[model samples]
Target chain A: MNSFFQYFADIFNGVKSLLTGMKVTGRYFFSPWEIVTQQYPENRKTLKMYDRFKGEVIMPHTANNEHRCTGCGICETNCPNGSIEIIQDKIDMPDGKKKRIIDKHIYHLSMCTFCGLCIKTCPSDALAWGQEFEHAVFDRTKLTKILNKPGSSILKDISE
Target chain B: MKEVINLPVKNIEEEEYHINMGPQHPSTHGVLRLVVSLQGEIVKSLKPHCGYIHRGIEKMCEKDTYPQIIHLTDRMDYLSAHINNHAVCLLVEKALEVEVPERVKYIRTIVDELNRIASHQLWWCSFGMDMGGLTCFFYGLRDREKILDIFEESFGSRLLHSYYTPGGLMMDIHPDFQKNVKVFIKYFRKKIKDYDDLLSGNVIMQLRTKGVGVISKEDAISFGMTGPTGRGSGFSCDVRKHHPYGVYEKVQFNEIVRTEGDTLARYLNRMDEMRESMNIIEQLIDNIPAGDYTAKMKAVIKLPAGEYFQRVESARGELGVYVVSDGNKTPFRMKFRTPSFSNLSTLDYVSRGCKIADLVAIGASMDYVIPDIDR
Candidate 1:
């Protein structure tokens, strides 16, 4: 008689635990407001991230078309993936001496991990993050960009 | 005379046996090896051996560029890749003295939360499998896949996305990401019931898990267990709530806790945490502040020489990255205080004298991923 009562008590406890768990889940299921989910793309205008969140590398161009990049190759040397490459040209100086001029600063957006090593390694304050995040393109070649456009003069203040 | 001779029988003595439970056991969850000494069914002693998956991440950081090292961080805790990326980004941003945009911070918070949910989902699935419930593993993975789908859309990689950079995120949230996340949460919230029905209230599961592997609150603190492991033991140490990085300060969510400090308590705490993460995601989806995702900073970022330590609440626990910079692109010395390392160390203390089957329960309660511990 005692063993039978023990079996019945065990069944009662099991049922009680089951119902208690169902109640907890049931509360979350019924309340739509309690569901914390965001629909993206269709809601791009509402999407938010932190202001200082690091995304990609970009160079800020001034209204005068002056850029701070001096072709120092600090960013190139510091890049872990070899994503940034700098090509230099020797320009004839007024004193009949040739000075090393930055011909190209190639940035491979495809290979870039966005680790910010190159940016952090730059001695010159020329490299800055541009806010354009939509860099997706059909041609992979488009991703390897020259931060400083050809014939664009270096910013005078960037040298210091 | 024959009966008297038959009565002279000898007794057999039980032998102490040593069972090595991995560097490669399916239930060890990584490359963790536990040398378990047992006499019959009860474990006499357990010694946890680590360093199997250690790639020497700290040593590797010295050779790789700051950006290159971010890839290394991805391999440390492969499950919560974004959180690791976020830690690296936060440290570099602090060192560089760069200001990130408001929009980027909000996005970071959302992604971080999403990653947390995904990591916990994997944890639940694996924990269930460890405890002898195979169905729960499938259920947990089914939900985890939805989150992985969202990650694939935005970052172009599911498991190891090097998405978070120093100044902001790698790309804008994918056009369909918001809708997918919403659907995922709705489906997952309903699925939680199915999980509870399948495993939580099972008599054998409850009997095996509850009141087993109990750790006192003081021991939990002394051992430095974090995330759900410590939270199960009633420690309120969530970096998201305490430090309030990115947009976590603005979003509302509760830090899930349980007072029992037992295996069942840890399991329940993780279940509650998954729901809380879903709550935070729901609140922020509609209100994501719009602006430039990346801040306008110099093309080249240079940091002044100083040591910086940034802590983020990873899915596992408090992930602290300590970086010393010598005004160079490469970090002078980088140290990562991974939560799994401390959490894994507590297993020996907790598993003593328990049955061999209960050792898996105790190890599962710790919720350790081997790479996280080894790295």
Candidate 2:
């Protein structure tokens, strides 16, 4: 007789627990304004990534067509994935000494792991993380980019 | 044709069959295949077949510098990415004898706890969804996003944050980091009650989990289970409590343990662990010191010739990093004693004789991340 009563008690407890759980979902059901999801594609116009987002490596070129990189190739050596390639050419300086100048700073987006090592270890603050994250391209060759603007030269007082 | 063709008699109870659970099943959660042998609906034995997602991270570590290895560690156990980075950082720091700033220690500890909460939140939701309750999936992710936002503002990546370098953090905490963390703590404290009401007290959840996947305390220790899985069996193996790396030594919190040694106990252990993590964060958030984020170190980090081991309590379990340095820029041989592989070994032991349907629940309760296992 006692076991029979206990069986019914267990069922009652189960149903009560189910009701309590439903109360949580029910509260959210009535309040439709409490939704937390942001429609991704629809909200793209208003979307802004955080300032510190490690999107991609970019060499900032000034309006005067000058960059900070001195062709030291520190970033090239520090990059774990061999994504950065620094080609150098010797130029006759005003002091009659041949100084190495950067011909092209090539960056391969496909090979870059976004680890920020190249940016952090750059000696002259040459590399910075760009805010642009949409790197998808239909062709693979498009990912290999020359970071320095066309015909850009080194900054005058930039330290190596 | 009555030619003495005698057929062997089949035993009624000896029927056993095998089925592959997944390399792609959602319940397995990340490309883990289990070969389950069954007699009727009862699981006779279980075998986990890993290496579907192995990336050879340990091999990659040999070629990379110590600072570069932090990124590789993040890829292993991506849920507890911060703690994984912390393990490698601590290993290098101990070997180099670099005393990181107090600020760095406080920030690392707080971020570690936040990562713990996020991991446990994901685990709880996934565990709940695996057990047929879908609401937990929404609630858990809803809260987890807040922590990710904090991470993004400070560390620049939502997941796979290589924030900790060898000697100290890669950068100082963002100006709003403390304020944002406090807001999250206050907000989550209220929501955790809802977690209990929605799932903890639910009789159906208890019925499915209680007394399932029972592992003895001795068996748990023998199997080398750590973190919440071992804590569920009352095998007090929290590396934070025992070893106390970072600023964990200064913090006050209880190491939650349960003696039930079952699926429900493991489930509850993580649930309580989330609360304990909050307690840890609340204790340290207001008292962070003003100092340098990193220590003064050379441009290149090369540990002296020796072997160094450092362990930290990750969201899953104890993540130990072993580095053998022969006085080089990179490690001679790097070994990671990840927790998931050991925890997965016990699945076959605990799930034997359980219904095959319960195997999903058992596996979920263990919370073994597969990439950590393969790595």
Candidate 3:
């Protein structure tokens, strides 16, 4: 008789525990207020990120077809991944003063770890985040971008 | 069929059987090797061997700049990469005396909480698998995927997101991050019941966990366990609550703790902690303060000569970082006091005399991530 009672008591305790757990879960299940969960891609219309959120690096260009980068190569030196490369040229000015110009500012996205070391090390605050995260391409080489515009010289205001 | 007995039999004496437990076993949770001496089915002694996955992260940090070293931290505790990044960033920010914006602090707190939830979810799933319940693994992963989706949408990467930076975050919070997080909390809040019904209340689970791997509060303190491991043993050691870094000071949430330092108590403590993290997230997500995310600092961030130590409550335990700056762009020496290393040390004391099968249960209860241990 004692053994039978023990079995029933054990079953009763098991059921009680299960019911108690279900009650806690049921409370949340019926609640009107839900926590944050946004479906991506489909919810692109409602998707939002920080404006200054660091995603990718880009060079700033002035309206006069000039850029702020002046072949200083500070970013290239600071980059741990060797993602940034700079090529400089000597420009002969009409005023008889030769100026160092950035011929090419190559940024290899493939090798870049996006540590933002390059942007932080820039003496000229000319490099900034472009907010372009969808940079996936068919070929790895396509990720390597040249930041300097063709036939463009350093901005006179920044260089001075 | 009976084989013929050996003609010459020597006098038998007492001998012990030594079994190597890992460096490759699933229950070890990374490349942790344990040498166990057994007397029949009972374990007599156990020795833990480490350093299989050590990548010399301290040496690697010397070669990289302040910003580049953040990536190295991501590899230390992959589950709580954001928190590790936060620790490094806080150290650098302190060295430079840069004050983070209120908005940035709030955003960092939210991301850290989300990462905490994801880490706990993975721990729950992996722990379940270690104990032979495969169903709980799927349930935990299913819930964890929701948190990962939010991270991927806000930050470009899912796991090793080097998002936190010195002055503030790498960028501002995603526009819809608040709303998305709210939805996730609501869904997760409801899903906790399913987890309880499936695993917590199960008779088999209770039998395996409830009274096993018991540790006293005094013993826990002596062993230096933190987070849920310490909390479950009745120690109130939560960095968010104690130190209150970022915006955690503004948020209201209970620090889940249990007096019983048993495997069940630890499991229950984490479950309650997950709920508390959700509670904190619910209150802060909608009311984020508006301000600049990044504080203005010099382009080349050079730290002053000083020693700074910052501690954060990672999902595993207390993750303390000690950094020495020699007024250079990079730290002179960076040392990490990882919780897994200390927590893993307690396993031998707990596992002795227990059945070999119970070793897995004790290990799973400790929540030892081997890479964190090895690093």
lDDT of 1 by residue, B1-375 (tens): 545555655432266778899988989997889999888888888888889988898998887666677788988898999899899888888777778988888788888888988888888888879877675676678678788768866765568777777787656887777888899889989888777776778676798899999988899999998998898898888888888888888877888888899999998988888889889889888777788777665544555788889999888899999988888767788899999999987888898889999999888877887899889
For each candidate, what is the lDDT? 0.81, 0.92, 0.83
Residue-level error in angstroms, candidate 1, position B61: 1.1
Which residue pairs overlap in candidate 2's backbone? none
A39-87 in candidate 1: lDDT tens per residue?
A: 7668778765434334567777788887878887777776776888889
Question: Candidate 1 vs. truth: CA RMSD?
Answer: 9.1
Query: Which number leads on lDDT?
Result: 2
User: Which of 2 and 3 is ahead in lDDT?
Assistant: 2
- What would the per-residue lDDT of candidate 3 be over residues B1-375, giving only the tens digit for each residue? 999888976433245788899889998878899999887777778999989999988877877778788888888899999999999888888777788888888888889989999998988898889878776676788789888777877775678888887787776667778888888898888888788876788776788888788888888899998989989889989888989888888888888889888899999988888888888888888778888888987666777888899888888989999988897887888899999988887888887778888888888888887778877
Better of 1 and 3 by lDDT: 3
Best by DockQ: 2
TM-score of chain A of 2: 0.92
* Candidate 2 segments exceeding 4 Å error: B1-14
Worst 10 residues of 1 chain B by lDDT: B4-13
| Order of quality (TM-score) | 2, 3, 1
Interface RMSD of each: 7.1, 1.0, 4.8
- List, residue by residue over A1-160, the lDDT tens digit for candidate 2: 9999999999999999999999999999999998999998899899999989888899998989999998888888888889999899998878898888899999999998878888888878988988888888899999999999999988989934
Worst 10 residues of 3 chain A by lDDT: A32-41
